[model samples]
Target: MTFTGRPIRIAGASGSASDRRHAIAEFARHYPTDPVDVIIADFMSEFNMATFAGRRMDQAGNAMPAYDLSFLEALEPALGDIAKHGIKVAVNAGVCDTKGLFDVVSRMVQAKGLDLKVAYVTGDEVLPAIQNALSGGQSDFRNIYTGEKLADWDFEPIYAQCYLGGLGIAAALAEGADIVLCGRVSDASPVIGAAYWYHGWQRSDLDKLANAFVAGHLIECSNYVCGGNYTGFKSLEHGGDGWANIGYPIAEISAEGDVVITKQAHSTGGAVTVDTCTSQLLYEIQGPWYYNSDVTAIIDGIHFEQRGVNRVAVRGVRSGPPPPTTKVGITARGGFQAEAWWFLTGLDIEDKARMLEAQIRRLLAPSAEQFTSLKFDLLGSNLPDAKTQNRATVPLRIVAQARDEEALGPRKFVKPISDNIMQGYPGATFHLDMRQGFPRAVFEYYVTLLPQSSVQHQVHLPWKPTARTQVIDISPPPQTKTYPSRQPSQAATHTDQAVDLAKDFGPTIRGPLGWIVHGRSGDKGADANCGLWVRHRDEYLWLRGLLSIDTAHKLLGDDALQQPQLAIERFELPGLQAVHFLFRNLLDRGVGVTTTVDFLGKNVAEYLRSRHVDLPVRFLNRGKL
Candidate 1:
């Protein structure tokens, strides 16, 4: 392998399973005319794993591929452009069935008379290995978040997938695979693999590999780095229309380990400015030390600088050896869940909610104990002296989860609530739709780690001449590091920042925290992270002082305080003028089983930004956003 010297332009076409399907076609369509070397799509997440598990359970041993069909549909239209321009494509849309997807794509390519070679990487599925370990009395599969032993889990695991590094992907690409399909490689693995193959970087090139790792992460979510979920939405023009036309991101990574993040030239909306890039950098990250299967990135020193329109230079990324072990997600059938909603109108909303809860509890008395989880929530408070009917009503939500569908079906869940309407509070009304009351299967997602050596990473591709398939085993990294379980202490930095803010800054005005700061939040399994940053260095000081873990818990209200695993860890990134918080177990059993209204915790940062804060009068005088 040899270095190309020229930078590789890798486009991020898909973020998740639900991302818009037009991106692949659009990127491919613009191809030769406006060249992009490669296109990568990420279609798996913890939530996706749970979704696939439920679907697998419903299939009952049906001989169907577990892969997401959207990827195939998206690629079918782009095949011509891909072939014409010789565009390399890599995606993790294969889910649990890489070979299935590989065969499908190969047939499609052959039918189209296209010369594209199709290959796949496998060995991510490890349920059999996990079962073997458990049978041998191995206890290494403890939950990464709660530290719970797998032996204590209530339900048996149905699926397990270890996150693989980019080496297997790189090997297939190096073997001249035009399209590389994968099963549960790390979300950033495609980009890492692309850069690895493009730059011909050795595994020992830690800094270069780390740079690709960070670049992969920044662009992995497609339009996210292009201001899709931006907190500073007001800055983007055309409002909703602008958002609908948001562009996807691309990383121009050089052999020297430098990267420039940008968007498609013809993108109708969204900008790739420093703030937008910073927002993506801070999202879904646990701390300054960001870990990938291939490299450990020290992001605390990283900085983003806007160079031109829709272009941001990423600099100062440092790296160390990757962790000895990689993460694995274990999924199990959590059982059935159902929910019902009732509206309380006008006066006595709290009393009405309390009465409804009591009535439902009494109605379920015979079998209530069978439920693994049950909760009633008042969604909102009724306004006083309101003119509109909608403003004066609060919603009462009842959610129940049980091991058996019978316990959550119409008789036990919906009928109990439906039978209470006439005996309920004045103007008591349930939602017109009752379908949500029907029980649906739910899966629990548990995250753990396994030694890299345990992964049997392999690449399946055809050799020349005979054109027969060959299985190439990819070894784990030659060198690895075991990071300390404990993180770097924040005591000194917290004390210094707190003291600076305590000193006089004159009078203060209470206002939304968003007035001076921007934030982004996301989930990692059951944990949620909120990253807040300011436009200027001065305001960052105040933000660091004000957003202590206690203050965050208060701003988060009862949800933060109510969770049994309510622990928050804070970290600071002075280079980016950002302060981030990681709320453990806040999403509750991950996205699959979480009953939180926010679901993936995407709204946590916005909620924190909406909270009123004692803003320095001096800062407020400058501008009021």
Candidate 2:
């Protein structure tokens, strides 16, 4: 039925597999006052997908699914509340085994004696097709970022999952399913599907679908749009929200496609302001265009309005038809990786690090040819003169990756390094845990695109007596346009000046750039996107002019310097007073196998902000962030 009442409120309870378990219970606790129509949890990611692939191999005949248990843990406690309130649930936690999860959830419902109609969407796993391609030696599957062909890949791909859209989800909900489980549906697909079902939206309603797409994208990360990863975190602390128990976000979408983002009314911590919304808006995005399986959202023109306490109205999102292709992730066993950290304390930190590295390399030189990669990172610098022991200490981390586990075993990799501790530099002590020196399997992810028609999207309605499953095909749009990797953004209304910001804003002070700027960063495969913005419109021109590709490279410091080819694409979003940069191949082979300490690149923006830059004294006079 078409929605004619109040907006459909969809609450996001979990962002990742490891998100706090109490969030769903929090929503249930506040259900009476802050009721929602549905709750959606997102659990799958490239990193976790790799984990599932590894588990599939390790637990070959295990009866239990290699699904993310965290989602089940978060949802089970709230099931009674959900059933009583008739609140629908959707989650993409069925990483590699949607059917297995569906069976588990069905049994749980039976045990609870609840009448919830559990449904699951599947067909995302397409490993057989990939296997066939491999058998035939087809090289059509090419990496989206590096253009590396599948045939040229060093490792043998054992698992492949294509991203599915929301049509399958909408079908299940429309068929009266109370709970929907999906495997590899786009992160925002649940929200989009719920909206589509609620409003009876058809594929012809491109604009409405686009609006739902944006709303889903916003709240899919749970509290991120509510200040979880906000750069203005201090504001949350001082503004009486205090951030300890940050509230999860809810998207209320109307039939007209307008969305109002809010949180549970009596929820503690975090506020829904324009800045917080903007932070999530700029996160993990590549350019002005946000591509999903169902629709391509044009977010460059999107704007946020603070509409009272803990409320933000999102507007101006446009959309085009879905692209012809959808993203496919292939996972293979990369190798084994092991790491060791040494504390370099007190005087001559650099000299000590050099000596330690020399010793380790000299010891490992016998079998160094067996190592696929080896690197040393000096994480921090010791303080000058007098300070506490912690202050005068920095970690010298050595990470080694190799195809052979024995190559990184204690006998070869660890014993040699650990044996040198006594003979190493003064005050040099290694971490006590010798197990870390043992190699762990690493999974590599290869991302590429497949035709939308190639995916077999299916919805399974288990409650149905007969003809329970329906095949839903999402056809590619008839007309599609290529979006530029980088788009020229609108210029600041206040200035056309090309001069340095110091001339316009006032005298400059050398300090952290974060004082006047706020940022949020995330990863897309191996690439990292750092989006930074300012609080005031007056600061937009200065920020846009100051943060260039060259500036980003310099600010990135050693990470950029170490890369063989440092590629960064900068784009502007003047409406939000933000500059976004996409660093290609920055995270190496994605988060799953990346040796970088940053992992998902969540702190790339923080790293950039920490770098010293000349900030206008006038801006700093307001306050340091």
Expressed as tens digits, the lDDT of each residue in 1-625 for candidate 1 is: 6557579999999999889998888998997556788899999988778778666555666744588889998999999999888899999998877787888888998999988988889999888878777778764588888988888877788888999988888888888988999989998889999999988889999899888999999999998899889987777776433765888888999998889998987755887889998998988988877787788898889898889888899988999998988888988988888999999899888888889888888997776888988989888688899999999988888899998998887888888889988788889799989998999888888888877887889998864445354778988888889987645535224554564555656677888998888999999888899999988777877778777777888899877768877888888888898888888888877888888777888999988888898889888777755
Model 1: residues with Cα > 4 Å off, grouped in runs: 1-5, 57-64, 137-139, 238-241, 382-387, 463-469, 489-498
Report the lDDT tens digits of candidate 2 across residue range 1-625: 6668789999998899879998777787678888988899999999889879888767767734579899888878988888888898989999998888888889988899998998898878988876666577653788988888888889888889998888888888888899999999998999999999998988878899888988998999998988898988888886755888888899999998999999877747898899999999898888888888888898878889889888899888988877777889999999999988899888888899899999999999987899998998999688887468898889998999999898898888888888888889998799998777899989999998776666677788867766634444444445555655344443332355455665677888798988889999999888999999998877777888888777788899988877876588777776788888889889888898898898989999998999898888877777878
Provide C-alpha RMSD values for all models, in order: 2.1, 2.3
TM-score of each: 0.95, 0.95
TM-score of 2: 0.95
Native-referenced Cα lDDT, model 1: 0.85
Name the lDDT value of residue 219 in candidate 2: 96
Q: What residue pairs are clashing in model 2?
A: none
Error of 1 at 197 (Å): 0.5
**CA lDDT of every candidate:** 0.85, 0.85
The candidate 2 region of ten consecutive residues with least summed lDDT is: 485-494
